[model samples]
Target: MPFDFIFNFLTNHSLSFSNPSTHLSYFGSRIICYHLPHNSHRNLSYRSILFLLTIDTLICQNCLLNQQLYASALLHSKSMILLFSLPIIVLAYVLCRNIKLYYDLHRRGLNPQFDIFGIKGLMWLDSSAAHENFTRMCSVIGDKTFSVLRGATPVVVTNDVDLIHAISTEHFDCFHSRIPEVLSDDPITSENIHMFSAKGERWKRLRTLTSYGLSTVKLKLLFPTIETCVSEFLDHVNSLSNGHSVVINHSHSLFQNHTSYVLARCAYGHKEKNHRVNNFLGVFSNAFGAFSDFQKSTAEKITYFFPEMRLIFKNSFVGHFLQSANQQKFLDYLLHLISRFRSRTINENNNKPSEKEPDNYSLLEFFFDHHNEKKLVEKAEGQIDMKKVKVEKSISYQEITAQCKFLSVAGFDTTANTLTLLFNFLAHNPKIQDRIFNEEIKSHSDKIDFETVCSLPLLQNCIFETLRLFPHASPLQTRICTEPLQIGKYEFSENIQVVINPWGPHHDRDIWGDDVDCFRPSRFEKLTEQQRKAFMPFGVGPRQCVGMRFALLELKTTAFRMLQKYVVKTTLPVNDSHGKMVNMTVRDTGTIWPTDKLGIILTKRNT
Candidate 1:
């Protein structure tokens, strides 16, 4: 009775006024609307009826067509969006992978305590701060070596003596050239190849060629020229201070002028009549000021941080040309000297053998004679091996002129500053000054020959002590690692950079003892051979300063002259109003010089 009631209810609810062309039926709960003949459902039996269910409504054709169109459009839009986003997804994945790889590489070594960004590495941000920060880290961390990111590049800084000896001397072949690897072969950068920046076979040739010019024998030959300058210098000072202690403002100026004169006479063959010392001085000062712009450039700082940055700008239109008017004047002066030398050589050759000519010539003239007489390929010591003298390329005029300019730059500031600081040191310590005068100056004041200058033990120690306390060259020496080498427990790869801070070793209490910070001249006498290695004022190894003898000679000569004349004392400040005698604190420029004028009371020595 319940089934019959349900069927009657469905039949009554279903529309009776249906079209004859259509029939309604149900399969489970789903309704099906179909077109059929008028008696299509009449043949259906009770068994069929039991299998089917009642339907409530018929499906519309137009509504189904609209629904299908909407679904297709939605799918197409989704596909287009996904297609457009594929490149972005790939880019993101690649970026993430590289960042992770770099992070892994960066953490491999001993890192400093500071977590600064790339700005610290960009040394132009603050060079003194950068050097000081690094020195501080080395002191605080107390490690032989540590890694730091200078810009994007990673470098290892060390003060280990064994490692320094290995790289600079024992394994010298593997690490010869400096970093920020010579990217440009253009004239602005490399046309004039000097010893300091030369590489490989060129470096060997230049070194061998220039060595004799600064040789012990050559220095002896040039001693008279240096003595003349020292005498002139002493006379100049005497003229200025007529039996009174005068406030000499530019102590550096007098020394600089003397060095310039020495270079002009001994290096350039320019006699007093043709001398261009004043002209050279003006050009050098201006040129040095111009080139120092590199220390402030972002690009150069980045290059200092990452040597490989050279690769990025190697072919760029931008250039590092020396555009200063002073640079042009210097080049012109060199040209003029070359022309005069050539004319003189030609005239001398044309003259008869009986003709009398002055035999006095300069180191540069000797170089010129060698260049002309020698063949293109000459046997010289190899960069790595002393025993194996390899055939090297001949030198050129460009190279010689380049060397002259380089030497002038290298020696001027260093010698001038050293002389200034030496005087300052002697002024502050009158006992040392008296000992130098009594032992060195008085002993050889009349003679003052080469041997006499070299014979000053106490004065030499004072000079050495001043050098140790304030070195002209930065304590940080940067060298490119040519081959893979292991330092202590760490392994370094080829083509990487290694920074050696001599300051760390020089100032280390453990190495130099408790009195390391004090300016004690006697410290040198007590230092062991190993301890002595820590004092590298002129650097070390094959790349040690070619002009070391020249610089030391100049320093000794100046100090001797000053001590011979004046019993000096530093003029202390009166209640901090007039300022301290001279701020012993050094301004860390390309060379180290005092911040203030070195004021001294130079009482004329009782004759």
Candidate 2:
């Protein structure tokens, strides 16, 4: 319609001209006819037409530019969406694969029943069944590397014997035991020189010092003290048995008490009465309970996905009560004992006018003498060179206290637990127990010396069997890899922690026969030299238990004296309260002890 309007207007206004150029000029002049209409209305009309054409040109250019920008923006939006979504898609696929692997492993019966978390099993194994379950899990997994729940934290479990050997021996420096932060938060942890607390140089020094103290010569020197403690323990037991049936929680009150007295006299030069209430035994028992509880709680919390809850839960009444009362009381008592010794030493030194005063024959005194002599040697060497030098001595007040405290804590409990379990085993297996008794009696009628007791083959076998079936510390010994270690087929990187389950290895079907769980002392007799080496009840290599000889002596003497007078028996049904024994120690509660309470029916054996 616009085209028709333009044509009609042009045709009606047409003025014919001769040449084409002349015609275009004539049309241009006629198109501006509105401006030359000889009136103001015509001029206004011409300006309106020019303004409309300018606006049209600007609008068309803007439309074309906007179309190009919109297309480019759409392309960029698509690229960004793809880039961000790619990672999510990959993550989803990986998660699905992991879940599938977990299910497949489970469905194939390759999963350990106790490993509920699929990472590491629970941190606390308080039952024999749990121990058994863990062993089974390791066997089924049979992999160089696998994961299990240590409470909530996932720990990678390895059955690589090479790794175990490396950790136990080659990489001993890297694989030292870890002391939980909670335990170290208090002075008790700091001042205790127990094997658990000893690490690096401090550990090395204390270990060397204690090793000397527990040497064959020192043990012989300490024989009388040990005998005295054991006699007292036997007397206590005899007094309690009135020819009637008696219930004995030997692990808790009796054996633990006796061991405490032995350590007290042998290590600290103090002999506290074990039978009395509120003595060292009582305090130690309370302290141990507190320590165990604290460890369990810490292990549980740290393994949790949300470990920050530990801080919030720290204000709980039980937590505060243990820290303020039990822990603090133990520390205060230890510090007081250390102070008393220091005062005595100071007075003795002051009283001696002569420089050649003979040293007192106490462990503490010996330590101080050596420590001072070391300082003197260092000072003399420095003076000869005219060099300023500082000599750090052994037996610092703190070191002495820590070492003594460690002895008191570790020595007593572990030995007591072992003895108690052994006793329980002897009580149930009267034939084996009686053989040990007869051997002890034949060795020495009145007094069984260290050498005599150590010679009894039957007694040694019994002890070895007890240690194997009911090791005090059940889990495989752990060590961190300090340097790269090659054990057998595998290589472990430095700083990775490795654990060897002694219980697992001891009970392994490949190593032991199908009757591995049976209480058989004769297994030792059948073992080849290689097998015997593998059966390390007290561990192996340089870092083995320092006080093993002392522990054996104590066990032999205590077992001999107890058995000579009494025939241990169980009056209660064997399986009635078997559950309580699970958390007690690694020993077999049922086989070693009767169910209700450990009833040792004492009968006077006429010599």
Candidate 3:
């Protein structure tokens, strides 16, 4: 008891002693520890400092005591040495590993150095001003292609059209799949891994299934359902307009109602419900809302920046934490919808419409049939290894949910941003709006069917030009190397990230002429060979967006209806500019978005 009390008193009081050696001597080892024998060596586990000091005294008793005291002094010095050295060792290992990775990338022609061990880069990426940061990144690295260290991962980012074409098309086999940011291998997330993440033959099969799901006949069938939704949107607009110019984005999002209804009918096999529990769209909106701004968790911030952390994070509690709470509303709704669709599919008239869901031959039902939901529903847990999917006749159930999730997001966010920017451009350029009304809108009948809108090339051009400006998702698209490959003179290792920046080439003076910054739909009229290859709003080649035709239809149909009835005007000045929409700011939060409020003036037109 006396020895324990002495050890505690000395160790606890040593905190304020400025010099560690002096503090150890002040422990009065001459008085207390002089009874023990002197032996320079003593064995004590690293787990406890108290045990270390106590054992040093005991070991000394077995030998002989001296005036200078024995192993007690040695223990103090050794414990302090180990404590001080550990952190420096850790810091050295971290620095060496990062420097080695960066050096390898530098040798491969990735230039100008990257953020110090990616700390600064991580902060910049996690910041909401990613677009602005990218512009700054382009300035330092130049407008052409360059590689940078995204954490320790080697990411090749480029605006080079030839290189983009070569990788995405000509050299497709070498760079076909993406490294997903969030690592998820759950039965549903793995099989239903969104379009970009699935690699090789499995990816090809998924694309085929999705492409078939959006066939011309299916689009034609789904057109009426979409048209009806758009009409309701226009009616809502009319009620707000009140026979005068009105702002479209005050109380709620500009296109939220319109997109929600369309997704409800097309993806959910039902009308959009207004109730809190049943409204899948509302729940879905709120779930992603959790990621907005500063709400991001610590685990999310780490994994989002480091692609290598995907596998580890997916297997952790953070993944569950993210899904169980923030996403529960939508997950519950999705499961409910799945149950309903499952019930209906087993009935006598499986392929036909039910009285309750007149538009029951939905995209949801179509995807389920292809996935062979019967098998998927049996084993709904654990992930499917996509690499060995040679004989798997159908995708799993989780794959079906994953597909619908992508559709819900892409179909809503991307199409919404395009419409927002389109309105702004049209509002500022009255002449272009007038030309569309006279040449396209007036030529067409009152009907806004899929076939009628498909024939409007000029209107289609406007949509193309707007997308050329804003792009389909983020200006940044990503892929990963499947094997050792060469692009130009640079040879890359397998699993390297290949980022395609559509923003750079889209605004390149060499490709789009000096008026590249201008909002001119006419530029798309006369295209050079290079320009056509450079234009990749919905990605490129076989891996391009499967819903391209559907997206175009939505744009044309919505634009036709809105333009036919209203003349758009906005708060922005019409002078000294060709629709100079520089006042508005855009950013990428997984997808491109207009951060400013989406408000435009709509004057009802009497035709």
Q: Provide C-alpha RMSD values for all models, in order.
A: 13.0, 14.0, 11.4
Which lDDT tens digits does candidate 3 get at residues 1-607? 5467756775677567554444335544443245434432133221233454556666667457653565788888998999999889857865787788778877776552566566665554444544455546776756576666655556677777888888777877676676555445542335557555565665666677778778888888788887877787787777776567677653126575567667767876875533223365577677663233334556656664455666777775767666646466766677788778778667736666545343455888777666665443222112323334453446667777777777776777677777877877788778889999999888767766567878988888888888887674643367777777777866777777777778777777778888777788887788889889878888876678888898888878988999998888876557324433443333323666665674678988876
The digit string of per-residue lDDT tens for model 2 on 1-607 reads 4334434554555455333334234434333343434443233432343443344445666788999899989999998998899878856754565465445434433332344443334433323344455566666656544444343333334444445555566545555443233324322234434444555544555567667767777777777777887788777766776564345744445676688777766765663565655267666666653223223454344435333455554454645554646556766777776567668768757997555222123465556554532221211100011112232335455567666666566577667667766666666677776676665564467766768877777877778877776655544345444455454544544433444556566666566677666667877777865456557666665567777898889888877777766667654444322222434323321112212235445566666
Per-model CA lDDT versus the true structure: 0.63, 0.55, 0.67
Candidate 3 regions exceeding 4 Å error are 1-80, 124-127, 186-192, 250-252, 273-278, 289-296, 300-312, 344-359, 373-393, 575-589
lDDT of 1 by residue, 478-501 (tens): 676666666556666665667766
TM-score (all chains, Cα) for each model: 0.73, 0.66, 0.79
Give candidate 2's TM-score.
0.66
Once superposed on the true structure, which residue ranges of model 1 sit more than 4 Å away at CA? 1-117, 124-126, 129-131, 180-191, 272-277, 289-294, 298-317, 320-323, 344-361, 372-393, 573-589
Clash count, one per candidate:
0, 13, 7
Candidate 2: stretches off by over 4 Å: 1-130, 143-145, 149-163, 173-195, 243-252, 290-324, 344-366, 369-395, 489-491, 572-596
Candidate 2, overall lDDT?
Answer: 0.55
Better of 1 and 2 by lDDT: 1
